[model samples]
Target: MAETDREIKDSLVRAGRPDRVEGRHVNMPVELGSTMVFDTLAAFEAARAERYRSGTLYYNRYGNAASFKLETALATLEGASAVTLTSSGVAAITLTLMALTAPGTHLLVADNVYGNTRAFCDGVLAGQNVEVEYFDPMIGGRISALFRPNTAAIMFEAPGSGTFEVCDAPAIAEACRAHGVTSVFDGTWATPVFCRPLSLGVDVLVYSASKYISGHSDCMLGVVACSDADLAMRIRKHVMAVGDKTGGQEVMLVLRGLRTLDVRMKAIDAAGRRIADWFAGQPQVKRLLHPAFESCPGHEFWKRDYSGAAGLFGVIFHPCADDDVRAFVDALRHFGIGVSWGGYESLVLPVRPVRTAQRWDEPGPLIRFNIGLEDTQSLIDDLDAALPLMNTGLEA
Candidate 1:
């Protein structure tokens, strides 16, 4: 049995050794092989039979020693009993959903979840008769009222995309536990370094290892960590059933990234806060939607739960024309226009708030910014030059 969350976390923090691998000193090496050879017929049979149980590894698709090592590291960090890796973040989430719910089960998700996630719920899960109801990201404790008899789980994103509304995760988790429903939080933003969702009562924690974990944006991977052994088994079964396995190269990349995650995260936190402060003072920026900012929704919850904020955050542009955004993008020198973030370089992207039946009046156009390791002065300079280029902001 695992010890307390603190003890588990300490073990995880100490397990990351980028320079050492398989008793070798190579910094990085691909554990590429679809098959694993057994010592004898009985060993092969035993491996085959033990495939369904924990502590046994058969093939790469099921899980290899390297994969399990990475999983253990993640589980240790998140204070989880076990973890499952997938080819992509979407696969991790999809497998988790399938493992946790049946065809008739219902799910409550934040309206502001990732676009692809919403698509999965509406297009795939809904088609299979799994009812998904969208809830306000700021619903907080009131989320309990939305629970139905068939509700199986609640999926939430902290500081949800486009609009940076941080949800009260503890309140939501408490409500879920009271009703015998499981809760999953997309911990891609905080990772284990910043926030420990399992410690905060979250049943399952998921992450896009492709982002901060990989750090280089060259590989794609996902991690699903769970505290319950039974739930972990279900997740693993679903992962294997769906053929959702990450490549050894990606796993190695994530391992390499883990070695430097602490240093990178600290740099990101400092630069991100400085950028958020800069945006707060900008005339063209109407609202700085970073959790560190006082005006951010659920700021108190974030301050209480999160050890630090990462690079990603949003800023609402003062009411301006679309052409102004075009000019601003063209003027930017350092910030690249892209979708994925958490890399060494900075990125910016225009995002339209996903409007639902509940549409609150937003102030202006929104742009999500992922501040990188670049010098604060240089990033500020780039933004300063781009602000006046907004054609729509010329007069009105």
Candidate 2:
């Protein structure tokens, strides 16, 4: 009998299940150890020889059973031939770029990528003699104009970080394919539940598992998924060589979090869209930077390429005094001020969009919000109470 396709939630729940276990434990046991003992010398030699070739598990640094289980689950989720777990999301990005690029390699990066990503490219990759050119996220199919004969790759983010400008990923990826250049995408925002970059012709898909995959704010982890087996091998080899490995317990947390990712993502999406729509109706909001809205740049591409939205979005306040902006955010009781999001608690952060290849002309401050599992009406009431702070110009 042919197996039928299951829904994402069902697949996630069933993923990484051991075929047979003695104790019948629902989750994979956390195997924590740096060394693996072998009975015979020949077995040790064979494992060492196959380390880079077959991804043999010889040492914990290379990865343990728990890490492999999580990697397998993530690979399945992202529709990738293989996946590599890393210490952090930034490490995933760095490792993928380092594996694919060489000195003098030319990279075309989206201008609106995460600030840390830009810093790494400009500071580290630049020192390595890698040439990086930032391009407008809305360039779409026209990005071919920026490609050079020596262009090695293109890095992009859908519904870009902070600003929420959706890029034309498929069109840009098609151009990269035609030119024989590698395509890398930051899939942290949408995750595989909402968008699959591999299906869109992207060769490498990177994620900050610490945000959505871990669900809780406790763990810090990242995973890089590759569609090509050879590319995956290269990434794995590089990760092993660089000693960039994730702990066994962190992998277990991410694996556990995967089971509930679908439900959490959907719930947060509904709440975020409701708040964004409500914000649009407010006169104090200059603009709503959400991919689902037509006002956002390249939103049509988002609607066409993405199956769903995440909880993160940005809002531009009407031109006002800095004190008013500060008062509004300071007055919020439900939304905690924080740097990262995707946890159980809602968070809000003030952001200054920094762009060189593009222009940001908003006259007011911008705030990025991460709607959590809180009740929708309760969050709305919190915002309602805070909004008066801006209207009254009160520091209270």
Candidate 3:
């Protein structure tokens, strides 16, 4: 179709388009649009049916070319039939749970999921009269024993949030399939570069792209990957109804991140192992909660399923006064003190595990470290310097 006189005059200016070009852009152009104008009534009707879920040019709320391109990249990564982009990481998880469940729905969630996830289950899901049960993250094939007749979905996120306990996801996924239950997984800690949850038989894979995928901590994004077309469509419709949308700029940020995901993950994996090993050898460190280390719970399963480990890990310092532990963290020079991780700068966070299925009986201070694109030796030096501060009061 030829450009209309209006397009030739002001449409290019309205689009913020570059000078008229005959060649293609190396990057996916960020086409900002909301109101889509169809040339004719026939074209409009055809679009409402044929192009609705296909991510073609339609209304912006459903999805646009920019968001769909990013979704396609993620779907390709995780071996999923479809991917839905969301506003934030938590939104992706919450939306999936809401879409697949209802009042009286029996939902099984891993006890070690992110605190935000647990809050949603405890507050929103429970308020709606949904039956929410928390199971051990390492329950594995035994998870089937907890499933009820009305069990609608089971959610799991591994390299467990604050505790760093990896889940035997394949076993749980297999059980979900046998019982005809939806399995939702969050592998944000280990993006598709290190792990692909869908191929492990999980029904839906939810991930936060804000961390490792964005690589620079500038974008807030989330994704849901589903291989079953019907299941994908159901979730997509729910997302549309709720008016959840991923902005074109945010999707573009993720697209930029993907160009280097594999190489970046490789570097992060090496640096993480180095730091975890250093922590393991420290006399003040009682336990290393790293997936690649044998001391970490579910390390065997991680080795079996994952191609690499995320740079994030947990450490428990041997009995030290709470003040001394705070002093130790305060004395760190290279690592930033923050809650979120998986960016270019290293971060250290004091974290405590909250569990109901299992008791956290360890008598020590727990801290999480996210080793970023930093010099391993410098990180080790910083850790080494901070270790003595933890023992300042104990040694006396």
Candidate number with greatest lDDT: 2
- RMSD score of candidate 1 (Å): 2.7
Taking the tens digit of each residue's C-alpha lDDT, what string does model 2 give over 264-297? Answer: 9989999999999988987788789998888888
Best by TM-score: 2
Question: Residue 394's C-alpha lDDT in candidate 2?
Answer: 26
lDDT values for all models: 0.82, 0.85, 0.84
- What TM value does model 1 have? 0.93
1-396 per-residue lDDT for model 3 (tens digits)? 003333222321222222346785645677688899999998888788855485677798888777777776677667788888889889999999999999999999999999999999999999998999999888899999999999999989988998988888989999999999999999899887677788888999998899998888888898988989899888888877789888888877777777667678889999999999988877788889999999999999899988889999999888878888789889988899987778889999888889887788988899999999988899999988878989733332
Model 2's number of clashes is 0
What's each prediction's clash count?
0, 0, 0
> Worst lDDT window (10 residues) for model 2?
1-10
Q: Put down candidate 1 lDDT per residue, 38-132, tens digits, no spaces.
A: 88999999999878554477886787767777877787677788888889888888889878878999999899888778889888899989998
